[model samples]
Target: MIAHSVEDPLYYLHNFRQVLQWVEQRYADLLDDQELAFLQAFVALEQSAQALMVRMVMRKGELFRSDRLDYAEIGDTVRALQPLQALGWVREPEQLSLDQLFALLRKDELAHGFAGQLSRPRAAKSDLFAQLQGLALAPRPLAQWFEQAPVGILQWCLQPLCDRMRLLFFGNLYQDWSDFVLADLGVLRFEQVPFSPGSRALQQRSEVDLAMALHHCTERLEQGEAPAAILDALAQWRSDNPWLARRHGRLLFALGRHCERLGDWDLALTVYGRSNHAQARIRQVRVLERCERWAQAHELAVQLAAAPANALEVQALQRMLPRLARKLGGPAQPRRRTTAPQLIELELPRELAELGVEEAVRQHLAQAGAEVHYVENTLLNSLFGLLCWDAIFAPVPGAFFHPFQAAPQDLHDADFQLRRAALFDACLGRLDDGTHRQAILDCFATKHGLQSPFVFWSMLDQALLEQALACLPPAHLKQCFLRLLQDIRNNRAGMPDLIQFWPEQGSYRMIEVKGPGDRLQDNQLRWLEFCAEHHLPVAVCHVRWGGPA
Candidate 1:
């Protein structure tokens, strides 16, 4: 490991030299001694040029207000070395050592020719450096002395040539260069050519070469390539190749989404549902919701909601719930959050020292002089807040407050728990602000005293629990519920669920419950809209003594 304290460039240079020397000399005789010596000289010349360039960049940065020039110079200089191509040089396909290959390439580049080029006065010569600087950079070699160039460079060159051919033959290219490039790179078998540079000669490519091509396809997809094209390529790959079923399933999910956009709803549903995994099930639910298939979406949502209050799974279900609600035509409601309720208030926590609500709550509770105290858990507080809003804001308001609302007598604590749970039940499908959603999340974040029957029930209000039970398949729900209970039981004290609710399930409905003085945030409202679109149920219950808004 590099020393944490060392900040000098020479340290990095020393390490780089050591690595090259060890890989070239001690590890193998991949490069001939003369070629290795030359490579070192080339590397030294480049390093020196880099040092000058960095200083130039720094000087430019000092003079100008912009950093772009500095960045461009550094980036261009580094990329000019063609690191990947260098590795290809000394690399022996049968016994390829990437380190050894790089070392050998470095040795060659550092030789007399490269050094002579640098030391000699700049002149108008049509040499490699001049050619490189004109319109492009150095052509990265495949191996130090290998005849074939790196697969990447070949693919790069092949793409435009293939496009030219397509434009010449077809009206327009049917697909992006990605699919073709990926195919070319992933070529499993190819007929060897004797120093040919024609496009036709390059048609037959090997599979190892195709690795980079497949990666290109993946990148194109990520870069928002037309969904149809991506799906078609993926489907063709699965059809023609021998991939593991699990791998195929993943790819199918990816392709299915494109199908969804292509108005092939049935195909999307089919692909999403075919996978037996829980993730697949959730995805299947999402596709169904997108199609406005509420009944199916509701069923899945309920199943997930009831399964268990695992921080992860519960989080997923929570995300799905609002969409399910919106699909069911739950009324449009204002978004609310107990914390950071407004744009002005959002800045309060950092700028206005006195406006810290949690601290205020802590102080209030501390001064109450009561022996018994509620857990200072935000979720628990939010749950009570939700219950409070429901009662005070219901069309016909009720008078009872949850036990956790204030200090309760010892004897009433048990009764308070029951009443509080019932209150949660009453607003079962209701949506609130961030405060209430946070409560549900927190409940799942911590362990319930028991595991099995009470697991989901303890974490959520009764109605949601019932809805979840009603909707989800029994087995899947059981798995999610169990997982929830396990996570809470395992990591008792950890970073409370913050920006990231859970992995893979980050895309879900997030609700916040607030009080009378509280109002919903724009982000919270946007989230509500998102939930509604996903057909998740959202009920914002404002528990004011007055009638519902």
Candidate 2:
């Protein structure tokens, strides 16, 4: 690690001479002493180049790990190498594709050059439900295969090349399919790959333990498992789970309520009828209401509504009481949150500030006199979408395929993810490179209504969009992508309203806005955590809600 940190070009020039003098003279009997020492220095020097390149891209640091130098199937080798040439450490040796660059670097592997093929076998699925037959009925296990599967050194060295004949028939062998399933396929493609039955791979550490349990229970429900069986398992897991009482109560209440809605009244009563769990008793009020046990339902509803925790329970109790009062022909009035409803004008988008947090962050940083531009949200995610386009979108062969012009059964197919991936990548590449800006713009211009879940491409064009992307540190982009992949719905939505882009320094900060009474939502907290981890500047801007002008 210490050796890898010495990235300065001048240091390598000075150190190489010192290394040769120290190692060669000591191993005097060894004929290849000088060559061995030089090889060792070369490896260190190349690593320094990779490290510096990463520093240039990232604000703090981002780990881009590979099993070995040959793992280009995981990608970005040439992309990483190109920047080194720009840095002047590497003088472009007259031409070779990105794939060939790896072969050239690892010359110790004597072979028929780049023509040699990787020899790895696909591992059999080992999840509990792997034995179940049929595509629809086959249980899609919850393991995160992309993070867990290790592309071992032996994979490339052992076994016959996976579908090497594809290279002869179709020029591009799509060798990514042969090696590194994580690169060519999504985690959803395979069963959870664990390090051992009881342990998991290092990268899989980020996966949430809570999500694993929730997914397990949800899958059991979907598979038509008996409600009684699911309830028993939930009971067992709850005993060992580390979740707080409130959260555990909520989960049980939700699952019980779902079972109740599905006519599993006895199971629902068994689960949610627990008097100790406050939320469960509230749901039991509904179970009683559905069962036409009106007197009991109204009695519990009246008791709970006075201090109900969940909003739905309050509404349900409120709605049910009035009907109950009228049917029983009684004078007991239904309770309301307030005697008179408070009203406010519903007009929105008053545009008090052009970009609220952006303008605010820019002004705040400016007072300290920091040079930065506070830009709004669109460009940040657009650039992120571009960086991840191919990996997220490209369809891997045999991994998934869409049907011909029909509604897609295999959503994991490359084309679907590709749709947004290519659009975002091309859009960003055009803005940054200026090569196909017009063509890319034209493609998007024709469809004014087209909007991506990931990118607001309609608003972003070539020039300024690229500038915003360049300003953001690479660590920020990589971190955002990781968080987005973790939970697509929540992570995608809660990006800060403003980004402070320092064009001259090529850096930026994310600033989230909240009016006086407003608070950060769960998703916003997740984004803030991501920003903090990457050392990307993020702050909550408290805006004073000034009375109407």
Candidate 3:
């Protein structure tokens, strides 16, 4: 009986042969030629692990085939000094025979001891592959090897052993092959499994497996697993794991995709916020926009724009804002301007004079370098200064485009004058009668362009346009409007070709061909407001050039 843990029967038999040879060599000088011959004869019992009493007597001659050939019984036969068993080798009398001994001893010693001797200097060199190969080729069943060790211990011994062989011999060619088997067998203790270095290391040179993981995740998501759970798992795993930046970015985006599919906008927002890339941020903003969370979307867009102009983000924000505005009842109305005590020249305090307004504006801009400008004043060039000085400031959440909120405030004397100038410019050719005459209005209108405030007067005289502007504040616009209308009707202003006096309303107004998609710039808006306020029935005709009106 050979005392050993027999994982592979053929390999065990070969190991026995090598041990038998060593025994023979050690006792060569001590024992007579006859004794040496006896040892050799006993070695023959090894018999190529196929031809022996253990094979012939046991129906199939399989070792450890039954519990009957117990260890104690087998050991008794070997120590009984039977010719087939000697020295440290154990033998069994019931299955041993002279012919089997001779056949086993005749085989070469090197085949059996290859793993032992080759790996003597380093235990890690143990040829697990060689043993596996030997077992695979064996004719007899060796079920005892699988049963002897506890399942956990067996896995401990086999997992890394198999992993090493799979990595060393197969490399990338058979990458998925091993992993599939492991996963199928339910042997992968997912949480405990050390991040398998094989695929991970290979992922550096090739992203084959990583890409496959992504595809698998997507498939799983499509199949309807909660995307949030998958993302949480990935997040926990990705948090401390040092991964390739690009690959990491891809995984984060994939996670965002799942959240987006689920319509979990808030979760998607969180996912994007954690990632560093601008592209990922853009993707996140898109999800918010899709959810119709314009304020948040616009906020992110402005934030990204303020720091660095990502063209992608800028374009996305531009496209998203108009849709959002329509959904949110259009852009916010400009707040009424506030007033301060009159000033002819700067009675500058020492501190104020030392720190110029220009410098103050620059400093303020620099210190508050938010990516998006929340204040409407920041959006327009000319109104910036007036707005800064006159608007009452309050900050509101979800106020993306305008950071500072302006509540309605009474206009300052200067603000009143500036607004009057805008109303005059806008009413120039459009108004029939007004003070300062046609020349004065023309100078303001020509210099200011359509969006200018100076255009307010003429627009108010036309139909319902004035109602819209009058709906906004400062009270004085209404006062200025009525005064301008009075002047226009009283032969105080010039009438243009487009201008016509409404006899019933006693006001001059212009006929504007306007419709949806036609926006009045600031200057144009004043005149439209004036028309609407005075009850002028201005017709809005939308005609396509190539089509019949």
lDDT of each: 0.37, 0.44, 0.36
Between which residue pairs do clashes occur in model 2? 366-369, 395-414
Residues 370-427 of candidate 2: C-alpha lDDT, one tens digit per residue = 4444444455555555454333333332222211111112122213334355544553
The sequence of per-residue lDDT tens digits that candidate 3 reaches over residues 1-549 is 122334344333343344335333432343345445545555454443212223222222222222233333235422333432333222332332223222232122222323343333222323433443444432321232223321111001112222222232222222422222222222211111122223232323133334335445555666777767767655643322223333445556667777887788888887777655436777876887788787877677667657643323444455565665566677753433322211112122234324543332223333543111111111111222112211111111111111011211112111222334544344332333332233332433343322222233222222233322222222323333443333222211211113233334434333333222554343333434444554443332232222222
Candidate 3, residue 439: the lDDT equals 38
Q: Give the lDDT of residue 290 in candidate 2.
A: 74
How close to the true structure is residue 446 of candidate 3, measured as C-alpha lDDT? 41
Candidate 1 per-residue C-alpha lDDT over 342-450 given as tens digits, one digit per residue, 9 for 90 to 100: 1111212232234344333323333544211222223222333332333222211111111111111111111222334455444433332324344444444442322
Residue 298 in candidate 3, Cα distance off native in Å: 1.6
TM-score of 1: 0.32
Clashes of 1: 69
Q: Which stretches of candidate 1 lie over 4 Å from their true place?
A: 3-6, 10-215, 235-264, 274-278, 294-353, 368-549
